[model samples]
Target: MLRAIVKQGLRASSRLAVNRNPDTSSYVQQLEAEWETAKPFSELPGPTRWQIFRGFQKGGQYHQLGMDEVMRLYRKQFGDICLIPGLFGMPSTIFTFNEATFQRIYRTEGQWPVREGAEPVLHYRKNRKDEFFKDCVGLFSNGPQWGKLRSAVNPVLMQHRNVAIYLKPMQRVNRQFINRIRELRDKDSAEVPADFLSTVNHLTFESVATVALDEELGLLREVNQPPGARKLFKNIEVFMDSFFILGMKPSIYKYFPTPTYKRFSQASDEIFDTCSMYVNKAIERIERKTAQGSTKDEKSVLEQLLQIDRKFAIVLAMDMLMGGVDTTSTAIVGLLLSLAKNPEKQQILRKEILGKLPSTDRDFSLEDMKSLPYLRAFIKESMRVYPVIIGNVRSAGTDVVLYGYRVPKGTHLLMVNSFLLKDEHLFPRAEEFLPERWLRQKDGNEDSANVLINNSLNPFVYLPFGFGPRMCVGKRIVDLELELTVANLVRNFHIEYDYPTETTFKTTFLYKPNFPLKFKFTDVKY
Candidate 1:
């Protein structure tokens, strides 16, 4: 019956065409037939293909605005969840901000759940099998490969005790960064340089590399920094920027040698080469210690990972270095920007830091960080307002019901936390940054701010680090970096933006500030 209808549609379409190919006529007929049958997806309101196509023609506004525009337009018209048409008249992608539905899907996500990044890696491995990705699979792979990688690394990277091994190294990098900030500030204006993002990137790269590879790249040092470190930083940035473009857009890069694909390939080589160099060094060091019978009780992340699989260790380190640097720095930028905008909150945090870290030279132990509740609250509040990653995506592993609609398996699900965070019912005065909202009472009473907020806010809505098994593995490291740096900065100086810096949404595989952040730094009086 369906074939008969398709044949009739093809006949009708063929009649109107001046000179259409068989393939084109057949595709049009199929699309028309599918359009008639797929009423459930169409019932969910979204912009028409013409509307999206018109925006695409108007100087690439569709690509520039990207998912943010989709979430905004559909959520306004269709409430929490709606269908969003894809580029080039592709099937509609599901846009959801419903927390209950998200929880249901995530909790039931199977062992081989599909994720957002599998396609790009699969393409890379297929094309560069001999050159770049010969030995290992990427972290974002699905099915058995993803399960294997996750299980091997989780025991070492995700544990609290194993992660705490990097505290002293992070402290050293933090101190170097603070000192670098002191040098970068002007004497008269008392403001740091406008190119603060570069500094933050350098710091985060140094810290993550130290922990992930067990090598001192000395990226924070003003003099005699490793040449490979500088190259690695630039390459990682290029890799991230190009990955987003190639992954999101309908480009000829996949089939032809486009400029973006060329850049991505080159950056991938540089990143892999740099990580291999460091991994080999780390392995040699461990071999020497073992041969000499030098028994150290606790091993670094690289060592623990090497015990599982050497190639796995190298590839995971590359992922950590390549993927972690920009994101961790972006979070720091968000935290500092949030505090800089609100001086009173900055002072409150400064008092907490000063009380805990009395001397500038003293390092913040894991215990010390755990004691500072206000500092933790401040970081959480900053992330809540300006998330480093805008939202989460899951390709449904099975046919699931979301928001009363039976969404089919393999449909793309984009949960827009940016929309969820701004809902006034979930968060009172949602636009304002109130760190106290995340605070808890110390009087052993039930009326704590955190308790109240927890009661009111749905558990699924506040996933800054994501949720369940697929949550970020480097979350603990990011936490240590933020707390230590914020503590040390507050201990030494009072943070305030010299001018009103406008926050614009920019994308480089993740959301980051598009403008310069010039912060005024006044020395604190004890």
Candidate 2:
């Protein structure tokens, strides 16, 4: 199909050229055909299609080979690029540790970078085509339709100015969350509950909801928390938890009513319905305001989206909610855990936070976030060590040479950034948590540390939010929430961990800490 498109395009171009030599035209056609059929997948070193089950250690399932282990083995066995035969129903996946190759693939990607669409999401939307998600298309979709949807929504969702609008509301949510944390912990005991992740999830949901729906859902409130909000949160967990089984593997669920599939379906339904309900209410609110002769240009993301396409707006809202709940909350957990384990770093961060903003009671404003550089550095360091998304997958948009091997067009390339970011060759004392590594000197000088980073380190290897045009859209929003939450916590109390934290990560869907994160928080003198 790609070949046909290229050939057709070449023929059309040839026709437009006047007085073209026949021989030159023939040569161009041959080159065009070659480019079209240039996929040389066999040249790449990768596991066979049937080796999915046996690729890893004995008794280890295909997807169960933790990303860390997978990267280590791949680097040891395969030099740069290695192919893993298509697992489940998906195509062969290419894992690369080569920074140059990663950059080449990203640079070659066209407007809509080819990638494997989320099979389970595609199936769900198709199944519910005539329902609430009839016009819903989001990040899960691929090709021209996905491109159109992304282009329409990116302006509204990806803008820094737009994302800044939610800061005050998010800070309000953070304050309520801090109060909730106070309720959950004791002054003497100072131990946070095991369900702290859930609390963070609520805070994230409330923040994203207020911005996305333009209505305060009051999810952080202890009493009278909306049932729909709880359902949405629970279902987001269900969807993410079930995604590994339903998303990575083939459609066994399509034939058999597996437990995972059922949960995925239920979660998808609840998410769509709940998001739709809020979207409709928001629309009604906008309508009421417009009816009262209000002429306001200020528009929430949802309102901006609705103006372009209503179904698209709802779908975007649903994606934002699910993404905010797990992905952002998981990072917050990792950041807090890291800070807890390193009291020295925590103290440094606290000093910066309190020194910049004396009052810890009020929420941080946009300007306040700018004043604390160490807080930003801390978050970056945490993400580098423990990224929420293990790898960013992109399909090769065109055939390219990777280490003298022919990488075919539309080939799935998994940039194993999580493992690469931790390579000792790239970062000195890679295992240690050093936010100062991200800090720069006040006077312009090529310090030893900065020199090493600039000369030796391939900056592309540390892509926590991905790269190029396809970068994560809500990155600014996540940064805002994380910085604010951490600033507030550090300002108010000192954080410490009770037990040694040996960071063991697992992947149910996304990479998250396998063990319970227990932190002891104590009030500090301000």
Identify the candidate with maximal lDDT: 1
Number of clashing pairs, model 2? Answer: 1
Q: Tell me the tens digit of each residue's lDDT in model 2 across 1-526.
A: 3233334534443343233323355644654565555556676776565565565436644455665666667678777778877654666778887888777677666656766637777777877746655444577777766655666666677787886677777888888988888888866788877667677778888888887777778777879988888787788888877876676654467667688988998899888888889999988888999999784677777778788767777888887876676788778888988888789999989888878788875566677778898898899888887788867788987666665566767888877667677777787777888887787754564332463244467768888777755677788888888888898888877888777566556764477766655577788884
Model 2 misplacement above 4 A: 1-40, 54-65, 129-136, 254-257, 293-297, 443-454
Q: What's each prediction's TM-score?
A: 0.87, 0.87
